[model samples]
Target: MTGPGQNPNGPGAGLPPVPSIPLTDETARDVAGEQSVGGLVKDVMTQVSTLLRAEIELAKIEVGAEVKKALRGSVFFILALTIVCFSLFFLFFAIAELLADLGLYRSASFGIVWVAMLVTAGLFGFLGYRKVRRLRAPERTIETIKDTAAALRHPGEHS
Candidate 1:
């Protein structure tokens, strides 16, 4: 069903059609409400609550879809990491063999492998630290929230 201001012939046209109920005397009376301040406030609160619930449900659905996508992506990364681990194991062994063939002792060749692994680990650690340092709060969302608060505090003032 199309929402307020939405085009009826747009994408939402494919959705289930809203039921057509004839406005009989009984139905009209049921639809009408007491014309009082308290009634108006209660009606507004009910609408707001319903809108909030719909928004929360939409968020949950969107988040679930995103999490599913992330899980699928993680599977591919895990497979890649597994293959790379095995490839690195063989690569280090091959390098050690090459060093030994070049007249270095087997122990010395393996010692070089240990040093190389340590250096690689240190480089990764440093990169991770730098990435962590670059992390910051959501600046735009914070700014928008501040603006909303200001507008609410002074309804007549435009910020």
Candidate 2:
């Protein structure tokens, strides 16, 4: 006979009673190794391994939190980008319409708008290219490498 979902003749019913053992630090130390110099070394190694595992777990948790923050910030950046793109599209249309109302044909007005955009793009591109070209080598790193090469070449010259 069983009560509710319980089975009287279940898999665990006929199992032998398991003995409980008291676990303590001394027991753990004794089970790991005998009291000797080798045992001391083994204990130290085990403690170091435990410490490294805890440090690695802490690093993983910190990195996970940083990734979550970056992802949250990215959502807001994406929303701002979408809104800005739509606003630019409407502004372009409005500029073209204004030009057409000033007596130009609609097609010509749109073409003028496109040409103006291309000129602006070209100006920005040229400025960006100049800035990139101006980026120089790391002076301190180059100097350090040069010093190292000189030292290697003339090792006996140093006092």
Candidate 3:
């Protein structure tokens, strides 16, 4: 659901921001002993793990919300489309009658109208099929997740 120019990993993408869990500064100069450093590393690791889990949860929640909205919208869209299709019968009937009034055989006029409607439906269905075929995975979101993973792996390196 990232908008135009909005970073996939930005605040908007993960509305519920990560909790304020303080992570240890691994670069801190004050290191009393190796034991303390190990404890520090452990603490940092735990914090990072928690942060990663939280970020994942945020992603799941956001995606779920967007999916629910799409599902609901599609349901309404289908309902509207169904109604429109049914309503089109009257309009096409009027067109057929008009054709018949123009000196064409009544059966011929109705046949032509039916054929035209079928061709139009086929054209639209083909276009919809093409659109569906062109659907792709969310590359930006995948890239953002990769970047986050890289950042987490190399905490000392700044990108």
> What Cα-based lDDT does every candidate model obtain?
0.55, 0.54, 0.62
lDDT of 3 at 24: 64
Model 3 TM:
0.48
Where model 1 places Cα greater than 4 Å from the true spot, the runs are 1-33, 99-159
lDDT of 2 by residue, 1-159 (tens): 444665568842533323222345667766676778887789766755654454445445445555655565555445545554554664577665764655666655665666665555555555545544544444433454466467658867863
Model 2, residue 66: displacement in angstroms?
2.0
Candidates in order, TM-scores: namely 0.43, 0.42, 0.48
Q: What's the distance in Å from true for residue 118, model 3?
A: 2.4
Q: Worst lDDT window (10 residues) for model 1? A: 14-23
Cα RMSD to native, each candidate? 9.3, 20.0, 6.8
- The Cα error of candidate 2 at residue 105, in Å, is 17
> lDDT tens string, model 3, 1-159?
555776888746745445546646755455543457688799778877776776676567666665655555455445545545864785667665664655666655665666676566555555545544544454445666787789878978988
Please estimate how well model 2 matches the true structure, expressed as its whole-model Cα lDDT: 0.54
C-alpha RMSD (angstroms) for model 3: 6.8
lDDT of 1 by residue, 105-137 (tens): 665566566656556555555554554454444
